[model samples]
Target: MPSEPAPPSSSLAERVARLEARQEIEELKYRYLRACDHKDPEAFRACFIREGADIDYGELGTFATVDDLVTLFERIALARHNEGHLVLDMHHGVHPEITFLSSTEATGRWTLRFRQLNLAEETERVLCGDYDDRYVVEDGAWRLAKHHFRSLWSLTRPLPKGYVVDEGAHL
Candidate 1:
């Protein structure tokens, strides 16, 4: 087989930078998901810019700043806990396609599989969606500039009747 010519050093450098950006963005996403499932609104808020961050979670209401989302998250999560409900949530992001429009800006698409079990309500919900996100470099760190998702499919069903539910609040 004929050997291919090596690319210029600049090309290689760009490639490396893109790869690093992708990894960093992926880690940022994981952090956001973990914070959400763990019900840590503060950690979740850290994943985005403190101000002027846009968030639209469909029926969950749209917000102009990360603080709005954080407040809503805390209120809903605390309400669930106080209602004797166990909220088990799982977020799986897959098939990410990220494009770097500039050194400081990028866009990404991801498929998300989200499942939630509300023990007090005896309901299990599964949601499949796509996240359309925009990123920006802020203070030398990549932060979520805009985050939105659309649900492609979802299902909710009741659990077995008369089943006992455990309060696994202390995880």
Candidate 2:
């Protein structure tokens, strides 16, 4: 049986719903940038769908599910506190171009520009990259289904060239 087409008004409502969902997805992306740069793995995990969130960090390829991402984040937490000698305080700014593919699904391409500071090495990489993401609505909230990071241009400078590194600096 052929289904009746949606009413004009219903179509408009659907458009509005998709727009609102896109906004929510964009906010989730922003939080991901903030939490990841801060190395707050717990906060980062909260943005995932809880079932099949995939994080592909370019070289790492792809993680199977959100549980796998959690395992990856556990490693990050341990390393940030134990493994790596380099200390970092970074600020990441995300500007995303978001598209709503459906009321439940969307995609985003985000540009990331960041400033990094290493208290131990006195080095910084002013880095830039693109993040392609897929977001979905689950259990009344938007969560990342998949994320891929592709770095474009990365430049390093000697601590901003004459900028003194104070003790316990936060980029």
Candidate 3:
């Protein structure tokens, strides 16, 4: 048999640190998605840096600050119709490709599977997109420094008459 292959060049500590950082970053992305689905503006805002973040969501608009994005998020996501939420959203982020540029800086790309219900318009939309993100350590935590979303495709159609959605005790 051939001689044993050489081990990785990085030390155990360095490898562990990198793994932990990746886990934190992935959790951050999931939290952001959960906030969107739950309509929690505070949680959503917490995902990004406090200021001066490059955010682009295509037709939804772009912002240089988290405040601007939160303002718009509140206007649309918090709207109500017929004593129920005006819009319901679900976000599934998958196939993350993360790379480290430094111990405290990294980049990630994710595929997004999105679904939305518009109560006011009686329409449903299914969309697929890609997210390009930059992450940095701020105040000892990973935060989104740059976020860009490009929609690959979307399908929107009117909901059938007499159809209803029951939240069933979950918001």
Candidate 4:
């Protein structure tokens, strides 16, 4: 039997650089999700590029600029009702697949397990989706250039009467 071909080798510096880039991109995704859950519009906006970003959140809306998305996000996530937030959200991102297209550009795919509580409507929603993203190094940091989310499934149900939710100290 013929011996298997040798795998390509990269220098230690190159390997380390690639690893660091991947870590930064992963952190970026985490920050984005956390910002959404926490209703931090500034942090959420910081995760994407300054301009000309392509964002498509399906039924939520499509935006050419990060600012546009931020506006809508503020309206929905920051709404107040009865001395409490109108909507509460939790985002859990998993199964990240990051692929490097170049030293300064990359693509990532992630699965999002999202849950939301609408206090005004007394509904609980659960959704699962896939995020297809493009990242680029801008001003020495990785920022999202393209973000598209395709929802796989979602369910919404009315909360039981007299149900109580403990928001905890975090809220």
Error of 2 at 86 (Å): 4.4
lDDT of each residue in 51-111, candidate 2, tens digit only: 8676787754578876677677556433442344245545464666777666677788888
Candidate 2: pairs in clash? none
- Best-first order by lDDT: 4, 3, 1, 2
lDDT by residue (1-171, candidate 3, tens digit) is 101222479787777788888899999999999999999999999999888799999989999689999999999999986667889999999989888888899899999999999988899999999999999999999999999999999999999989988754666
Residue 158 in model 2: lDDT = 66
Q: What is candidate 3's CA lDDT for residue 82?
A: 60
- Kindly provide the TM-score of model 3 when superposed on the true structure, using C-alpha atoms: 0.93
Residue lDDT tens for model 1, 7-45: 466487676777787788988998988988888888898
Candidate topping lDDT = 4
* CA lDDT of each prediction against the hidden true structure: 0.81, 0.69, 0.90, 0.91
TM-score of each: 0.86, 0.72, 0.93, 0.93
Error of 1 at 51 (Å): 1.2
Residue 164, model 2: lDDT of 56
User: C-alpha displacement of 59 in model 1, angstroms?
Assistant: 1.4
